[model samples]
Target: MLTYSRDEIAAYLDGVVDLEPTPDAAGLLDGVAEELHALDRRPGEVVLVALANGAALLRCFFGVLLAGGVPALVPPGTPTGRIREIADRIGARTLITTGHPADPPGRQLGPVQVETLTGVLPQRHEPGHVVILTSGTSGVASGCLHRFSSLTRNAARHARSVGLRADDTILVNLPLYFSYALVAQALAGLVTGARLVIAGPPFTPAAYWTAVREHAVTSSSVTPYMVRGLVAADWRPPPSLRMLTVGGESLDPATAGAVLDRSPGLEFYLTYGLTEAGPRVSTLAAHREPRRRLGTVGRPLDGVRVALRDPGPDGVGELLVTSDTVLRRKVGVAEGRVGDCLVGPDQIATGDLFLLDDDGYLHFRGRLSDFVVTGGTKVSLASVRRIANALPNVIASATRTYQAHDGTRFDLDLYLYEADPVVAEEVRRELRRQLVRAEWPSRIRTLSLRDLGHK
Candidate 1:
């Protein structure tokens, strides 16, 4: 099964989760877990944790697992209405939220407020299942049900991959709701008995620098957006920083180069995964082959395998991951029952396109839906969006593949946010410099702040 043994799992589930404060974290977590267990209970019941990213939220998160209940995590500051909707969708037994509850009879447990929902039958699942929400870029967000042991196993694997140790302090600036942050960062930190520093939702260069320095963070994870932000801000990693991991978006070679140039000693690992696979598929040790193999997301972790589903002539295909840690099933999906989104047992169709090279590395092409056939040529919307978003005046960008109204030919449309005439011209100039003719967007549409707001 590759899952942790009973004693090994207990080492983490019952062990002290080291946090920034270092001393009081254990006692506080125990108190919260004890108080949480004292409440009305049901076996295999699902509990919704809608708290922000901090010790309190993590305390509650582990508290649920310790108290023998399932936890469905939502982004901190998710709207109350939305939280309730997810609760109903998942058939949760209780809602654990921050701040005072509007209704009476809600019990206050330390910093969190718990409101029990009446008559909503809790969803059925095997014991120790944890639900993490998907990004929902393609459709409605679904809760991926993963066995807690599998998640910890994945975390342990990832921790070993990154060489995490007990003396290391892992900085989790990303929100806890994200599987990358939850499993790869938070749970991985716990698995290794590493100290964790919960830092940001509103990430700034100053705040990030302060966190790294103050905590002497040895390892941390960031998205491509954060990588760009840090590079643009001329961020210099502190001497204590030893390892940095990048995921959640494609890290272009140029961006990766810039990050390495800034901190030559840092071990940067580029990773790839989805919510369906317990969130970590592979990781490239960029520090080893930073320039030569910057394009690949490395090989699958130990006990994990990757297959190309229906590869085309060019060898790109939707990536399928086979691992013991793949989600058991999806909850809160449209089907209103478990297993609606199950593609196969112990396997998941990642829905992301990739190329498996002869040397056993996976090169991420783009999302399966992000590629479009235009003018007999396959064009990548993800590539188009990446190019447009790199322009100076572009705040954000999107791409669309469409056919001419008369069905004459297919073309790509590019949308750039907050672009003026000069910016549009700059984009065209840059596109010409970076892309070939067929790959170019047929139309360049400049969208203003107000226009985007209306949408």
Candidate 2:
């Protein structure tokens, strides 16, 4: 049985738990719940929420859930048209936001009605569903649906497995819309009765460390992009920080080594998951392992089963997962708009390729969909991207396979975003040193930050 309930989560955050710049979580949650209840939204109805990171956003999320209305969270800057398209496809009639221009009370966008929160009233509670959006880098984003019970269940199991405690203070730096931030960090903190320190906007390395030091934050989550930024800034974890969780992308050896060297007492956790599986499938606890594995994503989480399908000679194959936490169905894609349509089976085939080691660690090779065949040789785009991103001054990279007009042979095209001429030359040098001749990119192009997707 779980020790904490959603109703009691706000109570646990009685004091000034959230760090400076964000409102008190408990008060914000109550206010947002009051507003949601005033709307009189029906159970299971979808509500699109486009807000920036702060206490109000968190409150609105839980408030909608408590009001018996499904909440779909998107980034604050998502275009109004895109927001309407997502809401329409999800059958959502209400849109809640902070920045977008709306009428005095509300504005009509096609079938959706946009409204901003006003004064808070009395408290009321109800249960509803949650809709988490995919990164949508492929032009259209998919929405993964989950019940409130599924989130709390996995969160409780995760808290126990990870040794989360009520005394621990957690820092939430990632965007709340991402499943990793929502379930693994925010919800986990609520389940464990831990003090959540919400980091404010302009999320830079300096700001991250400042919050960690000021709040005595015990644990925090980060991505490879953030890791690179921290290392570039030469930022070191303070003594108060006990654990640093890395996900969203593979962590390179150099960055990991730098972090470990700077904070010898700090533990680094490398986790793996998709939005489909309640966003948490496996975790590699730093303390449990003797040494950090270079490219492995660790073992499966508790109650989750991972199996390989039709592995090659190297024992690499598609990873299939079966868990109660997996999404029941995902929204479908229509033309370019995503529609709320239920589609699924019992097991989810994660498009990622992996190889299980004798020690029971799962090593991530790359995505099966991103595999490129050139001159009859198969190459992993993930491997290429990892290698290129590790180079000095290279922010991010994307690779695609191109074939000649006659389709005689395939060539690899590598786009290195945010690299200057000097950095591009260095990248080439590193590529020659790290990759084989067949894996070398046929064409290399440098792009600005705007050209690449933010990880």
Best by TM-score: 1
lDDT values, one for every candidate: 0.71, 0.66
Clashes of each: 0, 0
Question: Residues 100-187, candidate 2, lDDT per residue (tens digit)?
Answer: 6654567432222357423212121234568787533111234777776788777776676667788888888777887888888788
Candidate closest to the true structure, highest lDDT: 1
Candidate 2: what lDDT? 0.66
Q: How close is candidate 1 to the true structure, as a TM-score?
A: 0.75
Could you estimate the TM-score for every candidate? 0.75, 0.73
**Which ranges in model 1 have alpha carbons more than 4 Å from their true place?**
1-38, 100-102, 137-141, 334-341, 369-455
